[model samples]
Target: MEGRNKCAACFRQFNKMEHLVEHMRISYHSVHEPMCGICRKHCRSFESLREHLIGPLPKVDCERIFKDRGCDLCLTIFSSRNALWAHRSTCQFSRPNNAILYRMASLGIQDELRIDSSRGKAVALACKMVGGGSDGSLDLCARVCLVDEYERIIFHAYVKPTLPVTNYRYESTGIRPEFLRDAMPLKQVSRKIQDYLCNGEPIWQIRSRSGRARILVGHGLDHDLKCLELEYPPMLIRDTAKYPPLMKTSKLSNSLKYLTKAYLGYDTQTGIQDPYEDCVGTMRLYTRMRSLAHRTQDYPLATDPQNRNNYASWRQTELERMSPENLLELSRSDYYCWCLDSN
Candidate 1:
């Protein structure tokens, strides 16, 4: 009867240890074959190859895929697959909405749902704002301007700082004296922001009356809201900073300067950012992104298998050329203006 174990190289079954030893001496003697005990990579001799594989040939991790679970968003590494699964189940970073949802919403027009009671005329209008931010107190440079259903400007003002900037580091961002000109004091700014919300047509009331939805537009809107110390529902705000499809495409640079260059074909930030220009850029980017989205259908899929393979091969070649470090540096260079901190 043949033995259960067989030599992988020769595929010869042996019934007895003596027979296997004899076969190794006779048949294997003519050929010099050294095998790594761990991975079976051939080397020179048993002792040398054993030392190379087992002693110190740069330990390569060969763990099974099931053993690894890592969070892709935050790059949180996990030891075991089960542990990774458990961590992902509770990790907000792994969620679908992630960081890019805000940007996607900003590209599309917001629908104002309202019913007209007096004239009984239901009207749907595209309402949006142009806003800007600068380095000041936590709230000094942040402001939102509201536009009506007719695209008429309704109200606008700087948000008041909630905390004093006595301890904050303002010079780090290179705040200029000219940038601070025409700035309202904290008290007055707060009153203005409040009055704009309360006294003037509240956004919800306008939506109700005009049967339209109000869209908040701004650059890096989270920072704007942070400065204002106001929290609007995510759907209400259209943050051009967060728009994803436009950002995913290489046409627009991540910074306002690059975006202005691409959309308006003009280089901005030659001096300080003009609040009005910044606002206009935000609107322009939104319009351009919306137009692009309207022109395209769903993401195109490869119809032919061979074509799909070729496309994937080309993409892999391009990606491999741009290593992780290269990609990170490219991202930093593209978004240095808006990127507050480095990794």
Candidate 2:
């Protein structure tokens, strides 16, 4: 017989014993471990944590409240339907237009742009804000730190704001006018960041060669990438904010501060925001998650072999015959997870 390694709780097979051990250590499967209040199943991460409560296979009991009280922006499940109605206005923002070229034009900054192709590795990044806008609008990135998987700083810079500083958000951001006086212009920062993310390959060519683009790991990446005026394929991004298992019961995102404290057992952003600290914390979280020995078969199939009918097109009897576990196994993740590639 061929040697086999499998997780007892989830029935996920692993190719090696060490991977099974690692998964057991992190999974902590027990009656006392954190579990989906609805599913009565232990979850490996908050992404899965929320998934059990709100996603495709959510419990019927939780589904009703979730639908009436879920906040799409923050992913919080409110106490009552009225509470959700009240919070929606505060949670969402009007989507910003492509801000890349406008930022360059407003700053009138120019610099030589170059790419360094050889340096290829995953990176964790964090952005510090300058202000929250004059009338409490959108915040701006004033500083950024990019730390490699090995915890070395590859790039760190104070970025000049393209928009006039409004509220400064000093208590949290710790930014001042002096910091921006000689800081790198937004245009220059954007170019350098682009080069780093793409290595030496043309951005347009990265899609053809999947490995050419360096992976970006961060929390609240949508806001940071927006402020930087940067675009990366969703496949290359490992965002803690949007990962389903790490989210809230209502399918909204959890705050980085809360996630760090709950999962990593530490406090962060207690005072002024330091991008380097955030970078390291974010990196640690990514490493911990990527180490999980998820079921390989659960990874999205590379190609469809069966002439299978769509779920909606299937007959009721066919659906009823399959167990809930089997149905969930057939579902696909909207984005990629490194666990899918792990051996």
Candidate 3:
């Protein structure tokens, strides 16, 4: 009979116990790795995980159960048939109404939103920058947009840059000289956005996640905030560009345009880029990631006291001797799983 020492992630078996120990040392298996919702086996990416679950020559047991329980969009498995049906509504989102954009534009959402972050909902932000400085080489904030989960514009405005505009980048932004003549000044606009985002939470309380501070979602938020001259709490921000699981296999950030097309199955930024549209796209991506269903972890994170020192050199010898099943049983996620956000 084959030895019981099998790697849980790759399912590789080794005759010698020492060989399995070396393999475990090299393999960086964790909950972050896309995993089979049924068998709990870790795979490299969602693409490979999809192949494992539903592709030709799939595992008989997993394929059978997944057929009924799995979500086609996120590849999550619900507890029951009823659960799967309930999840479909969330998994499948409706397209945002373009008419709302024109209506909101006329009203000028204008950063007057009252945030109640006690709701723990995330909002998406996007900005458009025009060129400043000699030869139009510097970026100056020209427009900004913020949207809620329902794709409702909470804030949208053309920002008058602090510096003189040299290039309007009209081919992309469609901003004309007249648009900024009466636009919100950058100082006033940034302050209003900052206040709205802070939502009455003090700086200290924001990081503790104990206050009503909103969780800001966006792509390249650092750049957006810099352009706007605003700062937000790190913990209260979710930038899709930096989220590890969303990155390319090469460990580089994927463009929002590419991510939208690949995951949301649509095209964006084909012509004049609308900040509202960017806001909607980023919002959809954020919510989609937050909606994933993973096994509720007990020692939820790898940093927990129970698993924190598991990798210490002193414990290495002991870990190597444990059965493969035992080692995997102790494995935990290195990062906080976004599924917890669903609660």
Q: Estimated TM-score per prediction?
A: 0.35, 0.61, 0.76
**lDDT, candidate 3, 87-201, per-residue tens:** 7775565445565564555454455656654434678899999999999989999888888887777888888899999999999987889788888999988877777777766
Off by over 4 Å in 1: 1-160, 166-213, 249-253, 292-343
Error of 1 at 206 (Å): 9.6
lDDT of 2 by residue, 254-337 (tens): 888877765665677766667777787777667766765555543343233331233433343565465544444454433355
List per-prediction Cα lDDT, in the order shown: 0.37, 0.64, 0.76
Q: Candidates 2 and 3: which is better by lDDT? A: 3
Model 2 lDDT, residue 105, Cα: 24
The better candidate by TM-score, 2 or 3, is 3
What lDDT is reached at residue 186 by model 2? 78
Better candidate number, 1 or 2, judged by TM-score: 2
**Candidate 3 similarity to native, TM-score:** 0.76
lDDT of 1 by residue, 1-343 (tens): 1343435423432133234333332332211133332344433232343234334442344222222443432223466777777866543211112123223222321222223323211111121112233443223443334433332234333332344333222223223333333444445643444334333455456534522433455667676555554544454455655654235233242676665664455565553233434555565555433332111212122232332342233354454455433322211111111111110
